[model samples]
Target: MKVLIAMDSFKGSLSSKQGSEAIAAGIKEVYPSADTKMLPLADGGEGTVEALVEATKGTLFTVPVIGPLQEKIEATYGVLGDHRTVVIEVAAACGLPLIREEQRNPLIATTFGVGELINDAIERGYRDFIIGLGGSATNDGGVGMLQALGFQFQDRHGKEIELGGQSLKDIRRIDAENVSPALSEAQFNVACDVTNPLYGETGAAYIFGPQKGATPEMVEELDQGLRNFARIASEDLGKDIQNPPGAGAAGGLGAAFIGFLQGELKSGIELILESVKMEEQIKGVDIVVTGEGKLDGQTSMGKTASGVAQLAKKMGVPAIALAGSITEEAADLNEIGITSYFSILTKPMTLNEAIDPDTARQNLQVTTAQLFRLIKAFKQ
Candidate 1:
């Protein structure tokens, strides 16, 4: 029998690759002669760079860049096995976790480090870019990034505006004359999952500002700043950036990519699956196994597991999910493509115990072995 094992990171426990390995071990215990292919998967979020790097046998590079609060930090990016495509997760530099809870002010956050990452990759001769837009701590309309890339946002007096979301309202001009010339030769595929517009009740500021430490008053202020930036971009750059489905993602960085970088926004799962050539790998596998740390209603909403299962279903293969925990809402996943699901826990345990790497690994292996044993018995 042939099996394909693909798993997302188990959060505090196992990484995608590690989870896949544990599943593979279990399957081997039950079907020693079984052929299994292990793959690492991730949605275009926090673990994106690591997952894609492992999946494609890519190399990782670390660089020092400015953080959300204008502090210096080290961030990592990846170059795929092809040596052409570079993957960057915005969270690496300006993510919420980079700052303390008390310091989570979206008003002063910046994505300057994201731009610096791109610039560094470009200098390294990479022209193909996959930018993962998730977990950002900024609401600066991406002006901070644009500034790092040599796009000038100037005040009425022709002086450059300061960085951060708070400075969006001071822009009187947009200039692209000094942008990195190599940027024109680059192609950007942005992984964006949300569809919030740039400004409004459901937009970037109003929707995500609070999570980034904005109070109600700050949300309104940030919203107006985004509106002003949008208007200025429209007038000076000839781009209507505020209305796109994902323009509000990562605090308006989506708009910046769309308007200035000529980026194509796509579903995060779709982008990652394509990058890893998932469909091609699933072709002749007898069964596909996939899962994440948790399976909930959101799992079916463009998550890694759902993406894998849907593809397997289309190809006439059964897809089973194994998760650390399963919620009642996850039952709906059956309607999508998950043929069956299992939780890897053997007995009740505290959250800390459940997340212990060795414990989780053992659970995954034992659970997988038992499931495959039943399958083998039925086949006989």
Candidate 2:
């Protein structure tokens, strides 16, 4: 029998590669002769770089860049085996975790580091980019990123605007004269899962500003700033991306990518699947195993496990999910082609204890062995 393991990272427990290896070990215990292939997967978020690097045997690059609060920090991105394609997760530079709860002010958080990472990759001759948009700490409409690319935002007096989301309001002009010339030859594929617009009730500010440490009043101010940015960008850049779906993702970084970089936005999981050529990997596989930190209703909505399951169904292959925690709502996954789902744990345990890497690995092995044994009996 041939089995394909394509599991997402189990959060704090097992990485996608480790999860796949554990399942492979279990399968080997039951069928020593079975052919097992492991393909780690991510939905273009936290584990995207690692997954793509592993899947394509790619190289990882780390560079020093400005953090969300202007602190110097090292950020990492990946270059795939093709060498021309690069994968970047925005959070590596300006994620929420970089700041403390007291320092979680979206008003001044910047995506400058994200732009620095991109610029560094560009300098290395990488023109194709797969940028993940998630876990951002800013709502500056991507102005900080544009700045790093040489797009200057000037005030009414022609003075350059300051960095951060709040600076979007002072923009009187966007001068692209110094923008990186290499951008003209680049292609960007942005992975964004949300559909919020640039500014309004369901827009970046009202929906996400609070989470980035904005109060009710700050949310209002941020929303106004985003609106101003959209207006100026439409007038100066000749593009109106304010109401486009996914424009508000990652604190309006999505809008920045679309409006300024002319990037193509796609569902995170879909982008990941395409980038890694997942369909081609699963061909002739008897079973596909995929999972994540949790199996919930949201998993059906373009999460990694569901994305893999859907593809497996199209190829007439059975797919099963193994998660760190399984929720009642995950039953919705059945309609989306997951044959069934299982939690790795055999007995009840606290969340912290259950998430221990070694414990999770052992649980995964035991559960996978049980699954294989059941399949063997069913074949009889």
Predictions: Cα RMSD each: 1.1, 1.1
* TM-score of model 1 vs. true structure: 0.97
Extract clashing residue pairs from model 2. 140-165
Q: Which stretches of candidate 2 lie over 4 Å from their true place?
A: none
Clashes of 2: 1
lDDT, residue 199, model 2:
97
What lDDT is reached at residue 194 by model 1? Answer: 93
Task: Report the poorest 10 consecutive residues by lDDT, candidate 2.
Answer: 236-245
Candidate 1 lDDT, 1-380, residue by residue in tens: 99999888999899999999999999999889999998898899989999999888999999999999999999999999889999999999899889999989988999999999999999999999999999999999899999999999999899999889998988889999999789999999999989999999999999999999999999999999999999999999899999988999999999999989999999999999999999999999999999999999899999999999999989999999999999999999998899999999999999999999999999999999999999999999
lDDT of each: 0.94, 0.91
Q: Any idea what lDDT model 1 has?
A: 0.94
